[model samples]
Target: MKIAVPVVDDSLRMAGNAGHTPYFAIFNLNGGMFKTFALEGLRANPKVVVGEDHHDHDEHHTCDHDEGDVEHIKAHDTMAGTIEDCDYLVVKMACKNTAKSMSNVGVKLQKYNGIETSASKVLSELASQFK
Candidate 1:
């Protein structure tokens, strides 16, 4: 089985929040051996938008899309894609939306409070649970 853990850095320290984590440490467990890799590209914050003053020129903003017309990009989208073959996701905490999105993709969620713990240690403990 495989497990995915959200991490803040390449060292595999757990992130404070799951959805906001920038990277995921994926562990592929085979018998007693495991291989790990880091997946990046997830953003913890939204892009900042700068507003322009209309007094300087004639400015017009128009949109043809409604609220439902736009597809919201949830954290799970990227996470799910990264760990698509994984069986479970272990994280410190996950928001409702993120949890729901992960569930929709057929990935189970495991809650862990070991944010300061190393990924190798966490994976070892998780593997023990199955035995």
Candidate 2:
């Protein structure tokens, strides 16, 4: 089975929030061995600037939904693609929208207290559950 964990860094030492993680650590479980890879693209916190107001002119600049909305969609798409090949996803926290998306794609979501735990430790605990 394959498990994907959202990691805070490339070292995979910390678990990150599902929707906002910058990288995903994918671990493939084969017999007693494990192989892992890192996926990068998504941003944990994307800055969305609405607009800038100019005092000289009575004009307000604002971003159209076309730009912001498209980026949002693309981010989710990238995230989905990152974990598509995995059988399971482990996250410290996930929003309802993210959970719904995972469910739609048939990927099982596992919740864990990952704040104080490392990715390897969490994976080990999950493996023990199957045994």
Candidate 3:
């Protein structure tokens, strides 16, 4: 089994929110032994932003979606694709859209409710559960 957790920096701290985190620490489990698999960067899926007058914007921005935004859907689709090989995603917090997108791709979302924890620690706890 593979578990993906959004991370903040090289220290491998668990990111508070998955939507904006740029890195993911992947853990691989085999026979109840878990090991670090990889540290992956987020794959970019750029959106062409056109202004009201039909001019493209130079800066990047996350579009505010109201349940049916195509751009929003595409963004989450890309996010989900980043960890598509993983069986589960462990996050401290994730927005509704992110959770929905992950679920759509068959990735289970696991929430950690305690204080800030490192990705390694989170994987340690998860390994205990599978034992």
Tell me the whole-model lDDT of each prediction, alpha carbons only: 0.58, 0.58, 0.66
Off by over 4 Å in 1: 32-75
Please name the candidate that would achieve the greatest TM-score relative to the true structure.
3
Report the lDDT tens digits of candidate 2 across residue range 85-124.
6778887676555575677676788877644557777877
Compute the lDDT of residue 103 as modeled in candidate 3: 93
In candidate 1, which residue pairs get closer than 3 Å at backbone N, Cα or C atoms, i.e. clash? none
TM-score of 1: 0.63
TM-scores for all predictions:
0.63, 0.63, 0.72
Name the TM-score of candidate 3: 0.72
Clash numbers, per candidate: 0, 1, 0
